[model samples]
Target: MATLNKGILGGFSGKVGTVVGANWRGLDIIRSRPKNAKRNPTEKQLEQQMKFKLAVSFLQPLKTIQSMYFGSGSGVKSRVNMAVSYTINEAIQVVVGLPELIYNKVLITRGELTSFQNAVLTTQPGGVLHLEWEDNSTQGNAAPADLVSIVCYCEELKNWEIFEGIVMRSDLMADVTLPAYCLGKTMEVYAFLNNVKQTAASTSFYLGQHLVN
Candidate 1:
């Protein structure tokens, strides 16, 4: 910080280049902008950053689905934000000094809608995924018109296949045809149900990893 007598630029009172000019007690004052402090993050902060990175990377692929099906999306936080918060707090685990996402605990959707019952997933030859579930749609609050959505992630190939409303809950079964590139890759599969009106969704079910045939 320095005091300026205004020799040439008659009473400058704003920022110009690297210095800031202002009037202070009938005197022009010039001060350099404060430099940003670059400090190493603490151990806790580093762990949190790692966890956030892992959560975001896994959820980013299903961002669109999350925005529509994660929670109620009625509070101060958006559905995507809710999903990220839930993932960081509930779905991530620390192993070997680094954060890793737990596949079975990770949820792609959440709501009051009824989810799958006795769901079974198997792969047929040529990259076909066969999903079978009990027809519990007529029970309780479940509706036959509930839409089924599937998500497949291939970590080795870094590929995603997201299918929304491909089948109905009453259908009891679904077949997801994967792309040719996913034929040889092992895939982590998940399924969820949302109402036909798209107002709510059930918690996603992890169908486990399957070696594509």
Candidate 2:
């Protein structure tokens, strides 16, 4: 790699013949194109690719939820990108040489707002999702008025039900009714808390997956 002592296009950006031209630091430069290797990927690379695929496929349906609950990323990265990276690195596992998602290790959101305590979920008839959590509003940056969010995913259908329940942190229990279409589908449920201002949210809690009645 070399610097281009000219404009961005002075050295060109594509390959011509055996050489590649590009601009760097306001300078035009020329370099030879490296030969391509037909070698197979290393074991580590294969594992990384598998984990990335798992994370992406599992998270794609929740892009809107991630954008709202995930971290506020920096520079060119958005919240969804950060969420995917986190899932790839932290929530994926190698079981019997196959990549699998460790659902409990996944975080839908992470922030200073205190997370739910002893959170639990129950599936009721008619897509009614009963969520119960001990109030932790006295801890960290949590507040009694903090809003709660429920993120439900149906793996078989690759569908999502993002519900901003009207319950607050002070509410020890709340029932969220999913759409009629989700009544019989198995859903992975997670809950989190966000400040009333919607400026911050707590780490999400995985309440386990169940067949919605």
Candidate 3:
């Protein structure tokens, strides 16, 4: 399978904090042409006419963490966690600023959930973020109904209401999406802000999958 590396490059090295998302790939469908049609349809044609099926494969959006600390001392005790407020189902384009957010060091890649599982991104710290499942067992698929959450702390814990808790499903993935049209062309991707800071040149936000008919 082909994969795209979305990691932060070299220009922006110090600002990027963390990232998490899935690498989903499914079979693409193709329509039967009239030239292939026949009066006496064979069993294969009959099957295709009845139902459409395709093999879909994808790596579950694994979790990841990358931290840039204040001091660089060997074995300095520092903890960082990501309080994710959103889930990404599609692509997001961020206009990163200079000095604070160096675009070069940042890269967007898939989160690796297991060892055998292939990952898209290179983690800076160590292993992937270990999220304790609500079910206790570490094996099997995570319940689709449950919300994925994380918490990141550097020095002190501030009162962050929006940072923690179930990021309401509505707040992340949408059931229906309106077409994005501009200059007589249609776009499939949608970009929005989950968290915003107007005063700073640097900030963090969340992104997720979008729906469109």
RMSD of each: 4.2, 8.1, 27.8
- In Å, residue 121's CA in model 2 sits off its true spot by 1.6
lDDT by candidate, in order shown? 0.88, 0.83, 0.22
TM-score of each: 0.82, 0.74, 0.17
Worst 10 residues of 1 by lDDT: 1-10
Best by lDDT: 1
Candidate 1, residue 121: how far the Cα is off, in Å: 0.8
Report the C-alpha lDDT of model 3 over 129-158, residue by residue, as the tens digit.
222212311333222332323322111121
After aligning candidate 2 to the native by TM-score, how far in Å is the CA of 161 from where it should be? 1.5
How big is the positional error of residue 165 in model 2, measured in Å on the Cα after superposition? 4.5
Residues 75-158 of candidate 2 have per-residue lDDT tens digits of: 688899999989988888898889987777888787767888888898888889898888788988889999888988877787
After superposition, the stretches of candidate 2 with alpha carbons farther than 4 Å from their true spots are 1-16, 19-35, 72-78
lDDT-superior candidate, 1 or 2: 1
If candidate 2 were superposed on the true structure by all CA atoms, what would the RMSD be? Answer: 8.1
Weakest lDDT window of 10 consecutive positions for candidate 2: 1-10
Query: What does the lDDT come to for candidate 1?
Result: 0.88
For candidate 2, the lDDT comes to 0.83
TM-score quality measure for candidate 2:
0.74
